[model samples]
Target: MTFRIGSGYDVHALVHDVSRKLILGGVTVPFDKVLRGHSDADVLVHSVCDAILGAAGLGDIGRHFPDSDPLYKDISSLILLKRCANILNEAGYAIENIDTTVFAQAPKLEPYKDEMSHKIASTIEISPESVNVKATTTEGLGFEGRGEGIAAHAVVLIRKISKKSG
Candidate 1:
């Protein structure tokens, strides 16, 4: 019954690129600007990955999947999330629940919250009820409010299910 908790935050600049799509929590949102990053740059998913890894005593996402790696270039963040899930399972940690928040200035995200939660939960092999996704605006107070970038924060609760075997 060992319980651990971790929190993570991530931000990425927004850029106008017709070739790039705005992806958040594994769901593509209709927006004129896309997040700029080496991978798909889904800030929400990245935050969740970091939270899960931290809770499991694993390193952050950058340590697991570096932006310098060609294999991750333009790769889907969902794949990275699945890998994090596998890492947690291998370490005998079971996810209890995850809560996340996204900050943005435009392209209202209310319509896509459910899909985001479901997709993230599915990727982690957990129930959708265990994952919660929320979005908010900075009220013109920061980079997100200025529409310059998007940021996300995530918190995860996990418990040790079994001891790792040597």
Candidate 2:
């Protein structure tokens, strides 16, 4: 079986806007600040989508879902993820496993990691056990450490599906 691995990273600044909700991994976590982006700005989902697309030989998320497009304005990152899965399927690829990590300094994410993994797996039509979600702090060394922004990294393993002989 042909296998490919890809990694992706993404970050978004946090803004003090009560009108915006803090969504991470498709789950809304109550926080004073929300990520500023054209979409819901779910860093975890964005990173995962990029990783999958990269592994499948497709372009990055920005190429497929441009921020300049009004159609993606305030769109849910989960929706983008679903489209990525479809793109991979069309390219004759199947996801094997995915690992991801979220970097932040506030609003602890341990409580939501499992849910995040499950949500991502469901969105990609993969087994929950195939996805792993983790979170960490920067120990006060960067934008994420300073709570000014949130970032996430994702790595995915995908394989080409072989056709069955008649």
Sliding window of 10 residues with minimal summed lDDT for model 2: 157-166
Local accuracy of candidate 1 as per-residue lDDT tens digits, 4-88:
9989899999999999999999999999899999999999999999999999889999999999999999999999999999999
Prediction-by-prediction clash tally: 0, 0
lDDT of 2 at 141: 85
**Residue 121 shift from truth in candidate 2, angstroms:** 0.7
* Inter-residue clash pairs, candidate 1: none
lDDT of each: 0.96, 0.94
Candidate 2 — number of clashing residue pairs? 0
RMSD score of candidate 1 (Å):
0.6
TM-scores, each model vs. reference: 0.99, 0.96
Worst 10 residues of 1 by lDDT: 157-166
lDDT of 2 by residue, 1-166 (tens): 8999989899999999887899999999989999999999999999999999999779999999999999999999999999999988888889999999999999899999999999999998899999999999999989998999999999999999965233
